[model samples]
Target chain A: MSTAAIAALTAILLVGIASTVIGIVGHRARRTSDFLVASRNVGAGANAGAISGEYLSAASFLGIAGLVLSDGVDALWYPVGFTAGYLSLLLFVAAPLRRSGAYTVPDFAEVRLRSRGLRLVCTAFVLVIGWLYLLPQLQGAGLTVATVTGLPAWTGELGAGIVIVLSVMFGGMRSATFVQAFQYWLKLTAVTLPVIVALVYFLGSGHTYDRPAPPSFPERTTVDVHTGVTLQAGQDVTFTAAGRIDGRDVAPTEPQTWTAGSRHVVGEGTDLTFPAGSAVPVVAGGPVADDEWLLPLSGADPHQLLGIYSLIIATFLGTMGLPHVLVRFYTNPDGRAARRSAVYVLAMIGVFYLLVTLLGALSRFYTPQLLVGGQTDAAVLLLPTAVLGSGTAGAVLGGIVAAGAWAAFLSTSSGLVVSLAGVLSTDVLRGKRLSNFRFATVLAGAAPVALALGVTQLDFTETVALAFAVAASTFCPLLVLGVWWRGLTAKGAIAGVLAGGILAAGAVGVSLAGIAGTGVLGVLLYRPAIVSVPVAFATMIVVSVLTARERPTDVDAVMLRLHAPERLGLSRDAVSGRDRAELDEPAPDERAAGPA
Target chain B: MSTIEERRADTGTVYERVQAGPEFADLRRRLRRFVFPMSAAFLVWYLAYVLLASYAPEFMATKVAGNINVGIVVGLLQFVSTFAITTVYVRFANRHIDPAAERIRQQIEGPAR
Candidate 1:
């Protein structure tokens, strides 16, 4: 086996073992409260670590660098949008939602709106968004494992799925909090150390950073293609090929020159040698010159104003709505701790994103071959070896990165699955027993793994962004208006959620099916948040105004509970205590008043 | 205190009275004072950055220093601004919002020790 592969295998194994051990060690959850919300006793710093850990999915760890490497400065919007989402959370949703004392988004919806139907609607969207988010993490695991070990993609997906399901099923939220917190530090060390090493080495070598165009090979470079790739070259050139090119097989012992400015097909299991100073043939998308790459929003196609706006809107508003992220806020002891944890999350996520962006920019110089192979996602994994020349240090760094990637997949997928299980067992399956939770965990974790095995073509970050867009459209309005506005009727919420969820989810569906043509329709469908979010908010407001009489009788009490801090010596504890008692009894009318 | 507890036990009256009381009002005002304006300003600043990046490409690409263009600086500042906002809000909340809220809580739930 290759040294890098061995290192990656070791990393994956260590991550899996460490997470499972942590899950077992922290397995003290004996009640529903422990399983669902960690008994709401987590402190600020640890919860912050767990929050950042789960929030930085494969999309942030691997996809950001890949996006930056391929798309250039415009891609920086993703990291910015991601981190700033927490700022929005800290300012608006964090404390209020925690004060509401809901375990899941659906719990919040039902508790605040006093409607079973809205809860059901929220449950469905939570499942959809959770599964949508889970798909990419699964696919990314498959891709990472394949890149490192040359194994079939499904093996990695299956491995990550099993590890996540086992740990989550064992301890649920209580264990997940500790596991995710550990993962935060693991991922930080994983990405940051190698990047610092690479940067110092790069600077010490006195490499030129002033290149005015798309990256070219700094010297003779050989790229091995594990899968077939179609590439477009910008200029005529000659190179050595020891594999199949353009459906014609070339003997390994023989070398051939190829013409540029035309499409060339490199078959699986081929090696292509490129001379120094030659432009890397663009794959996966069109060729981008260096000048366009360095400029914001000017790469290749140049007119993505609408797309950029859509991304900004989706991410800025979407963070508060993610099921995994929201559930963490429930682990905080009080509303104040929720807010404090968010502050810590902002710092943690911001620092991590800064490091990943640096890695992305550096990959352009070190791993341009990833662009050629249409495997930019591997840039983070392959960068160490690329820069340090495949020695012991490079293998160790690659191993650490591999471990980080595994941590990303495990932490995120486990969070999503646990939240999904909480909602499913509590709401849909009507199962309060721990065994039922385990069954729901398997069900929740299995669907995404199955879907991921079949759907491998979607870009990880883009798919995750779609999930965010859906959340932004559906839940952002729900939480914001639910917390701040009292005129929100259950009927209006129902209508708004339906309108927004359907529109945005339909856009995602159409985009996924590849039915939206590459025109205005496609752009709109690919990023429906700009239109869908407004439509939802307006629907909610107009409908609420029209149906004001349909507002819940308990709206005033719920508002007081949400906005009033726990320290405010109000009836919050009395209400919460009563709510908990009502929950234990489980009467139909009292169920809505119980802790969700 | 017993009367207060009894009043609070009467379904919604305790919260309603607290909501109308000076401490709760001060708490609400303090929280809203920070969150509302801060959210608006941040959103506007963020949107401006996005708009500039999308619509004003050349201006964003203009070099600010050696090898550091306007876009890079602005992107870095986005991170800086997030940290700055977080630090400022944390400090502000500790001093302004937390105290008011704590006072209200004391009025209702009594002292923490």
Candidate 2:
């Protein structure tokens, strides 16, 4: 039939295939370990693939393309921060957290701090991060589907939410692992194949690429583009069909034609436009400009130094706190295996990022027309179609890309839903049955779906970044201190986590409530990580020092477990909670057990 | 849950039939040395990527592909390098580390020949 029908069928078929695959794998691997950590038996290749799958979410694949297409060079930070964040995961948190043998972040908190209260606090952070991260993925799905099929945006998002929830409910982590790993290759193939084919098509077409035109009014003689522009978010703005400028009709058809400093004056009542090729500078108002919320602090003003750095810190520090991401480490056989897994994940994440940048840049160059609707989310598909010609080959390539996008979202979302369910069941509904855990999964999945549905009005990037900031502020510091320092007390952890999480989440809530966007409150409210991370770190350290009496005596044992890989094998089975305390210090039991 | 606990306790009796073998401690020491430093180095390398990405964006944005750019190259390579590292890690672990750890564990806890 039509393009919309083709796109719709492609989206549904991809999700269906993915869900079926996960269900089959998850059903076969049905065990606690499989459900939670993939049986701690995942191989390097598979784990690497799964890591790629989990890592390349809508943000990486779609958001980066949009950013790069919309803004030159500066948008590179998204991929950089995203890929590099894993490095932070490798160094400060990986091995030690893994060595603790905890299945989730809250589990680590409990083991490190020896307090159930701390576990609950960490559990809260995990849920927050999961939901925050979930929102963007959902929003992204909406944008992608709506662009591809001309369907209502919510239709795509809600459908995605349902599929992801079903996948998680059916398979849990074990299945998600296989699905994610498989999806990575699928994603790579989808993105790269299209790029290669499209490149060939463009070159084969015999058109010498034109140099970008001078920034000015579009050539008045070119096809009139004066139709009222409708933003994907459903906002509208009117523009003159053609403007008479310098003795000819100038229509702003191509961005490449814009000069460095050209400006456009809309009609008396109309708004403004950058020169055709000028940075699509996101002004403070209008549909596109609203991403200022995403930028948070224009710390460098036209430069975004603080906002960029804040994002960097968030992604770098934030990875440690991501529950689903962290839970994957536990599936490795031991602490050393966990560390190796992190390294592998980092490498895989890095490679896919290169492709993401290409896609982003190509969208602006090849599909500048789509930029009007901020169709960067659909660039991977649109660019290929534009280059390959709207034919069967293009449709096939588009379908493959669509499948990758679905897989990326489904895998990560399933992972999140599973982890959220696990934590909530164990920590919130302690002593609950398996059914209760499943119920938690439904609850956890549904909340984000509701939030995603409600907040369809906001910019996708900003919602996602707020999630990252909260993750960075609340859980990142908690994990860093919990793993590295001996002085991290249960009371301290509880206090620090609550303080950091509350402050950050509160700031986000206040900002979302339409408070004035001017001074100190705005900065703190918008970019809470700069404020919250340090506060969490300081609070943990200070509180721990004050509450040393409650400290575990096995500091030395814990250190050995964390650092010494020698006695790490089966002896770990001998290590008890009390032994952990003894490891941390010269306990009375050290004398009782005598020398090894 | 109780049955699983009981079965686990029954399994504990088997530990008595096993004895630590002569090669166990030495193998443990060797495996520990190999795995620890290798893992530590990779961890350091991984951390360096993050530090570079976070603190050094300007350097990253330099080009590698036509316009693909170094930042993009480095970012994508992160995923590739991680897999390569992981494959090597697993090969090393299976060949050098796991067999040793298993040998040591079996000597201490597995039934004796």
Candidate 3:
């Protein structure tokens, strides 16, 4: 095995061991009163770490750098939108959500609306969003494992799926706080250390990207084609090929020429070697010149402005709507602690994304070969070996990065699995028994692995963004309206959530089916938030106004519950859905455990 | 777990009365004064930044100092604005929102604690 692969494998194993050891050591969710105040009484800072850990996921860790490499400055908005999401959460959702005393998103729906139907609908969306989000993470794991270990993608998916099921069943309900908080620091170090090293090395090397041509090979380079790519060259490139090129195979001894402005199809598993100074030929969609790449809106074709706006709306509003994200807020002890945790989260994730952005810019100099194969998602994974020359130190750094990527997948999938299990055990299965949660974890973890195994063409970050878009359309309206508006009724929420969910999911379906055509309409469909989000809010408001008589007479009481400060002695004890049945009421004394 | 008298004793009017009172009014107004305008302002600021990056590539690409382009600096300022807003709001909450809310809490919890 290559040293890079061996180091990466070892690093992944070590992270797994450390996470398990910490989780076992920190199992303290033991007493009822401790949890009557909150789960584990998780401090604001530690809860912030856990929130950032789960929130970062595959999209932030690997997808941000990939997008920046492929699309340039405009793509930096993904991370920006990601961090700014917390602002809305802080301003509006955080304190109110924590104060609502609901166990899950579905629980919040029931508590606010007093309708089982609304709760069920919210449960449906949570499952859809959770599975949609889970699939891409598993697919990303497959991609990284295939790149580093050269194993088939299914093994990665299967292996990750099993690890998540076992760990979540054993550690998730017991010691989740310690494991998730540790992961955030591990992920930060994983991305930051390599970034600092590469920065020093790159400055001394004096490489510049302002030239008129595409980035060139600094040395003789060979790129492995894991997926078929159509190379679009702006300048002439000559190479020796060992696999199918335009349906014609030549041995490694044969030299090939790809003339400028011409397209050549390189089949999967082909290895092409480029001589030094050979201009890089980008894949079909990306810009081939450094000049085109360094500017904004150059890489995205058709409707660049509309696309950017749609992406902006999805990420900024979609953040608080994510099911996993909302559950993290519930871990905070009180409404005040929830708000404080959000601020800490903003700083933590913001710092991490800045380092991610720097690495993406650096990948232009170090791992330019990724542009050729259209596998830029590997940019962060392959960067250390590329910059530091694949030696012992480089291999160790590569291992750390690979391990970090595994950590991203592991932490995120477990969070999703635990969430899905919460909903399933309480609402779908027998009841909220420990055995039911364990059984549901296996189901939740397996379904996505099964889907990821069948789906091969998934783009790592864009798929996650699609899930975010759906969440933005559905729950962004529900929560924002539910918290701030008293006119919202069960009928209104159901209609609005259904309308938004269907429209958003339809847009995703059309785009994934490759029929979202190349026109203004296509841009609208591919990035639908600019259109769907307004429709959702409008539907909720209109339907809500029409059904105002159906509004729960207890609206003021619920609003007071959501908005009142914790010191007011009004809020009920938070019931974690992991162990408690959804409709089961907390004992009156526990509810009256109010101010004291 | 619930009976008609227990439901009657639910004391729903107390919450309604408290929610209707002047201190609660001040509390709600205080929170809205900070959050609504601040949320709108930051969202508008972020939207403006996004729109500029989309519409005006040349302006974004203009260099400022030492290879740092206007685009990157503006991007970094998004970070700055986010952090700055967080700091400002935390201060606002500690000084303005929390104190008034605390006053109301003491009134509501009188002899109840």
Candidate 2 overall Cα lDDT vs. reference?
Answer: 0.61
Mind giving the per-residue lDDT tens digits that candidate 2 earns over A1-596? 55634964675576656676666555653434445676566666677677768877878767776766555445655666666566656645665666666767777766666677777777877888898788778877777676566678788788888787677776777777777877788777777886777566655654321222211122121222222232221122223334543234555462223233333322222223433333332222222322221121212343244555566666657777787777777655555545556666666676677677667655554665444433446677567666655677666666677777776677778778888988887778762344665678788888988887774333445555677778888778777776656677888877788887888888777755545365444555666777788888888789888998888765544543453333334223212342234233433422123112
Q: For this target, which candidate reaches the highest DockQ against the unseen true structure?
A: 1
DockQ of each: 0.50, 0.11, 0.49
Residue-level lDDT of model 3, residues A108-144, one tens digit each, is 8888999999988888889888998998888878887
* Pairs of residues clashing in candidate 1: A213-A290, A214-A290, A567-B105, A568-B105, A569-B105, A569-B108, A569-B109
Model 1 per-residue lDDT tens digits across residues A149-266: 8899899999999988888888888889889999999999999988899899877876554455557787898888867887777556567778888898887566665455577888
Off by over 4 Å in 1: A218-235, A240-273, A284-287, A514-516, A568-596, B1-8, B20-26, B54-56, B64-66, B106-113
lDDT of the structure predicted as candidate 1: 0.82
The order of the candidates by lDDT, greatest first, is: 1, 3, 2
User: Ranking under DockQ, best-scoring first?
Assistant: 1, 3, 2
Would candidate 3 be rated incorrect, acceptable, medium or high by CAPRI criteria? acceptable
Name the candidate, 2 or 3, with the larger DockQ value: 3
Candidate 1 vs candidate 3: the lDDT winner is: 1
Scored against the true structure, residue A86 in model 2 reaches a CA lDDT of 65
Model 1 TM-score is 0.90
Q: Ten consecutive residues with minimal summed lDDT in candidate 2 chain A? A: A214-223
Q: Where is model 2 more than 4 Å wrong at Cα?
A: A24-30, A202-303, A335-340, A456-462, A510-526, A566-596, B1-113
Every candidate's lDDT: 0.82, 0.61, 0.79
Maximum-TM-score candidate? 3
